[model samples]
Target: MNFSEVNIGLFRLVNDLGKEHEQLNIIFTFLAEYMVFLLAISVICIWFTRNKESRIMIFCATITFTCAFILGKVSGVFHSNYQPFVELSDVNKLIVKEKDNSFPSDHTILFFSYCFSFWLFKRGWWIFWILLALLVGISRIWVGVHYPFDVIAGMILSFAVAINVYIIVPRLNGTKKILNVYEKYEGKLFQPFRKTKGSKTRNY
Candidate 1:
């Protein structure tokens, strides 16, 4: 009927979903927040390890996620459309206004960027990162801060950033550094994966 009525109806629908799938919602939120922590540690780890490929990868992930956060904040400021996920207590609702801008959720960006970065560091971890990111993306919509379209947009942006990093890292001056280190250890580095292992072990 009226706008307020529509809003109330939507809120009730979302709240029902929260009640129905609270466990999934909690899991996604935890995964998203944990990425923030993991990404920070990854930065320190890369800086210490300072391998050629890792340096480039860490630089890309940090820069991309930073840009993503800035973009989300900017969009939140410029766009108009604020919706609340939960029914805040009357006092809290009175004190703070809801945020606007559903496009390109910062949460999604944070998850995907971290996922991509972790994937680069250890390819085996990619599956875990991807699944976690997927759950986080869905949670944004499930909890009602982002529209499904908004989450999709964030995913696209994250994918673009990751792909660009993949393509451009090689062109950087850093690629030489990575290659040089490998070159110096060519016999060991270039050997096939199977042979390189067990070389230190006895035949028996």
Candidate 2:
């Protein structure tokens, strides 16, 4: 099958699966909406880690996500793709229909960009982050809003931006200043990772 055919077939399969159970719909919807907040939680937790490396990586991740979002927005202006519900007849849309461009799933880009940042930096919990990102992407598809190629494109963009961010940020002269400021106030937060009994706290 051609790429577009496979994409449509996968969308139909997931849409059909979504109809099989209300519980599954609830689960996937939750993953699609709220799971992106894991990025915020991750950054907050990493801030209190008191590990200089991880703290620096979080700063890089911030830049990565910002750039990824802007890139997605610019792509939307140049390349338009309608939501499946709008383009296709009788789609089983589980989420509220969005009128915005759907060529590169924004939620997928957000989730995968943050997760790919961890992967690029060799940070902790990258595997978990990747799995969560996958779930969120699949949920977007299952909800009948995004095509499979949208998710794939989001991931590809995410990897490119994330890897470059991790690599380029450390080399920038301003990045060292930012990292220094971050480290200066690092342990002022509730650092649960500090040693309590002479043993280093485990990195989450």
Candidate 3:
């Protein structure tokens, strides 16, 4: 009937699954907690590829994440809720989280911000990234660290920010200039490792 009721119902549906299918708790816990490090590693690998397009995509994702993070903080200030485990009885809580404003799940905002930007930039593997973001959001609820509405709010906010960043960031001349300057220094640093023009192959 009310939004709070609906939110709690959805949270129960997902959180209870961990109780019924205890095996899945491991996977959901990983998604909820450790997947962030995977995302970070992926970003670093992409940036080190020395590919211009990939670098630009990473740049856009970073900007989207930063903006969404700021917005999420502001949203938290206005609307806040404790973790579901703290508020509800018999919650299938799988992860430890500090009691604080759990509204607009920070993990959800973080994953959706970067994942959506990756989806927008690299359409070829769009489903993978989007699905990953979705799973992370759901996992937060499944682990009893967030309510459904908290994850949903984060997804909505990050989706909007991702779209705007994708539309606006790449088109700016300043973006190109910054990339160019960084690449210039990068090339200088890696110059010794580069093969010279018309160099003879050295016998191993």
lDDT of 2 at 170: 83
Give the alpha carbon lDDT tens digit for every residue of 1-204 in model 3.
998999999999999999899999999999999999998998898899888888888899899889998999998899888999899999998887889889888898888888898888873466887899899999999999999999999999999999999999999999999999999999898776675532445533
Best by lDDT: 3
Q: Over the stretch 1-204, how does candidate 1's per-residue lDDT look in tens digits?
A: 975466455445544576576666665555534556775675677554746566666667776677666766666566535444343221111112256555567778877876776575553356777887887776665555655555666777777777666667657786677656755686455467647466645564
Provide backbone clash counts, one per model.
Answer: 0, 0, 0
Give model 1's TM-score versus the native structure. Answer: 0.59
TM-score of each: 0.59, 0.83, 0.93
Clashes of 2: 0
lDDT of 2 by residue, 3-102 (tens): 7789788888887788777678888888877877767787888866767788778788778878988898888788788988888877778778758689
Check candidate 1 and list the clashing pairs. Answer: none
lDDT of 2 at 72: 84
lDDT by candidate, in order shown: 0.61, 0.82, 0.89
CA error at residue 95 for candidate 3, angstroms: 1.1
